[model samples]
Target: MNALETNGLSKEYTGNWGKRTKVSALNGLTIQVEHGQIYGFLGPNGAGKSTTIKLLLGLIAPTAGTGSLFGISIHDKRARERVGFLPEDPSFCAYLRADEFLDLCGKVLHMDREQRKKRIAETLQMVGLPDKATTRISQFSRGMLQRIGLAQALMNKPDLVVLDEPLNGLDPYGRKELKALLQVQKSQGKTVFFSSHILSDVQEMCDQVGILNRGQLVECGKLKEMLPVRNVRLKVSTMDMDTVNRLEPLVASMTREHHHWIIQLEGASRTDEVCAILRGHAQQSIEITRTTETLEEFFFRRIEENNLERGITRPEPIMAMAEA
Candidate 1:
């Protein structure tokens, strides 16, 4: 079953003065996440990533369309019960200690006292804050607070976890630790849906990715399929200036390094043709490797294409709020 699904989910905000000015925070965003998968929501700043999360959390109502969590309507309070959420900026009772905060969350979830105690201990350790269980939240560092927020989200042991900009306040070590925790959740058959600006982490951790631009989903699919081999690189030994000039049209680019020439073919299909052309040149050996566009590259390319399509010289930020 799909963990999350949206159909033309859109949100709009109107100016305080009048209805004449309107902003579309999210525009007809339709996407899905399957069970037990790590889905990454990627976009630049103010791209409606957080807006979508808020809508899913039922913090705001959508102006158009609908969404669901594990088949339950997002509008239904019960739907949120099965979902754990960590907002981009989370605020808690600063006076409460870490363990107290988690215990309070457990009580809110109606977990039994014994169960809450056991889960709290496990969660604190899982988030690398076992030693800080007695420390007040106000005394915690930004990274530590983020970890505590994550722990509370998992305290309920919900089937689906939604995190907004989860790596924002984390150090390198903390980031790596969180990534491993996410992987562990996946292993245990829990679905993970997160938004992040860190493309490298998304590229490494997500099985599926959706790229949002100007409140629209420009790309969504398996990470592997979304990033395809854009070109092929061939290393040849018998390549000289004459060979380079002759093969210039067939290849995207070429350069000589030390004893061999590095040629970039436009596509994989041209590999055989280029190899045949190089056969008569008496090359000792040839090494051909396909190069795929990275997630960062694909993201910018999509944004650029979208801008060009809309005749927009400079893209404006998408609205990130919904009208009451």
Candidate 2:
């Protein structure tokens, strides 16, 4: 069964009561997250990431269309029972200890005292916060608070985990630990759907990614398939300056490191041409590597393409506008 599915899900808000200005927070967002996969929801600020999350959680009703969790309507209370969520900015009672907060979460899920105790212990350890159980939440560091917030989300042992900006405020160590935890969740057949601005994290961890722009899904697919091959990087050593000068025009770009030159060719088709040139220069120590566009590069390219297609251009400067 699909972990989550949305069809034409949309949300709109009225800006002013009298003016009746409508702002579309989400528009016809259709995507599916399969069970046991880590799906990354990506977008710039105010691109409807939060709005879609709220709609799926039934915290806010959509202005159009619908969604479901584990084949159950998102509007159904039972759907929430199978899901766990961590918001972008989570708040907890300052005076409550880590364990106390998790216990309260368990109670809300109707877990018994014994079950809550067991799950709380396991969750704290899972999030690498076992030692912070008795520490007051007010004293926790930002990373610690994020970990504890994740701990509560996992406390319910839900099948679907929805996290918004899950890596926010995490140090390198904390981020690494959380990535490992997410991998563990995937191994146990849990589906994770998370929204994050951290492109590198999404690139490394997500099985599939959906990109949202101006409240619309511009691209959605598996990471490997969505990223197009862009260039081939050839690292060559012991090539003479004469050869470098001769071959510079045929390649897209070249940069000199301490002892070797890194050459970027437009495509793999140029590999043989580059090799022939290297051989002609009597260079034997050459390494040819194919490099694809990174997630960040692909993201920007997609957004730019979308803008061009829609004729969305930057406004003219004040002076230019006045002259026009």
Model 2 clashing residue pairs (backbone)? none
* Candidate 1 backbone collisions, by pair: none
- Across 1-324, the per-residue lDDT of candidate 1 in tens digits comes to 599999999999776785588888899999999999999999877789999999999999999999999999999998898889999988899999999999999999999999999999999999999999899999999999899999999998989999999998999999999999999999999999999999999999999999998898999999988887888999887676676777889988888789888998775778888888788677789998887899999999998898788775763445633331
lDDT of 2: 0.90
Residue-level lDDT for 181 in candidate 1: 98
Give lDDT tens digits, candidate 2, residues 1-324: 689999999999878768878999999999999999999999888889989998999999999998999999998978888888999889889899999999999999999999999999999999888898999999998888889999988988889999999899999988999899999999999999999999998999999999998888999989988888788888987778888887888999888899888988896777888789889989978887777889999999998898788776755769998898
Q: Assess every candidate by TM-score.
A: 0.83, 0.81
Q: How big is the positional error of residue 20 in model 1, measured in Å on the Cα after superposition?
A: 4.8
Error of 2 at 252 (Å): 8.5
lDDT of 1: 0.92
